[model samples]
Target: MDLYRSGDHYVLHADLPGVDPGSVEVSVEGGILTVKAQRSERTEHDVQWLASERFAGGYMRQLSLGDGIDSEHIAATYQNGVLTVTLPVVEKAKPRRIEITPGASEERKIIEPADAPEQANKT
Candidate 1:
């Protein structure tokens, strides 16, 4: 499984060849995302084929997700034997704006609190 991010969206791409869309199941539970694909056996008959690179089997892969992902809002798409899962991250997880306040120009002061104990005084 390949993981990536674009803006507020996180993407997961899995390569599942010869697997039907119905057989593929994707879900996120307890902050962990899993992709499972089950393939059915195809009875082969005596036939001549020039070349075949595809294998005949099922595939399953799981990935541990972080807390930034939105577990409820997840979408998946299967195209050309590639399963692409898209998950939107939480609003707080995305980059946020930090309000900058302008202050009056004054001389810089480096002074500790009077009541606070000094570090040098400690053993």
Candidate 2:
């Protein structure tokens, strides 16, 4: 499995050759993302196999997502035996530049209480 950040989303790629796309399942719960796939075994009684090295069973993987990720908008796609999952970052979590405006005046004003004697003397 390979994971990387792309723009405002995180992309995950997993290799699942010889596996049916219909048998793949993805779910997220409690900030944990789980991926499951099943590869059926070949049942051939009339033919003899010379060698069998490919995996034929269940495949599962899990990942813990951070608070910045928007789990509700996650997407997954399978193509050419490769599965790609996209995790988008929340709008509030994204970084942005803040604009600063110039003030109208640089003068400072101080308000004094009516009963204050020291403030009256300064004025």
Candidate 3:
């Protein structure tokens, strides 16, 4: 599985060849993200098995997601033997640019607090 951050959300990709799309499951609980999948093997008794090397069983993976993740909006999709999961970060977790207004750095520019007038009267 490969995971990477794209913009405000994180994308996860896992390969599950020959696995049924309906068998894939994804859930998040208590800040933990879990993914489960299953692939069934051929159980025909009449066929003679020559060689069977492919994996066939349940697949489960759990990841400890931090508090920043928005678990309520988590989404997943399976297509062409690939499972894709998207985890979006909360609004507070997203990066915000702090605007640096033209402060008192220049003599022509003056920065005053909202309570500046009240403080002056008290002085």
What's the residue-level lDDT of 94 in candidate 2?
A: 93
Q: Candidate 1 at residue 117, lDDT?
A: 67
Q: What's each prediction's TM-score? A: 0.71, 0.76, 0.76
lDDT of 2 by residue, 1-123 (tens): 999999999999999998999999999999999999999998888888999888999999999997989999999999999999999999988999999977888777676776588767889
Cα RMSD (Å) per model? 8.5, 7.9, 9.5
lDDT of 3 at 96: 98
Model 2, residue 120: distance off in Å is: 36
Every candidate's lDDT: 0.84, 0.94, 0.91
Better of 2 and 3 by lDDT: 2
lDDT of 3 by residue, 25-97 (tens): 9988889999999999878798888998989999999999998899999999999999999999899999999
Candidate 1's C-alpha runs over 4 A off are 46-53, 100-123
TM-score of candidate 2 against the unseen true structure = 0.76
On lDDT, the leading prediction is 2
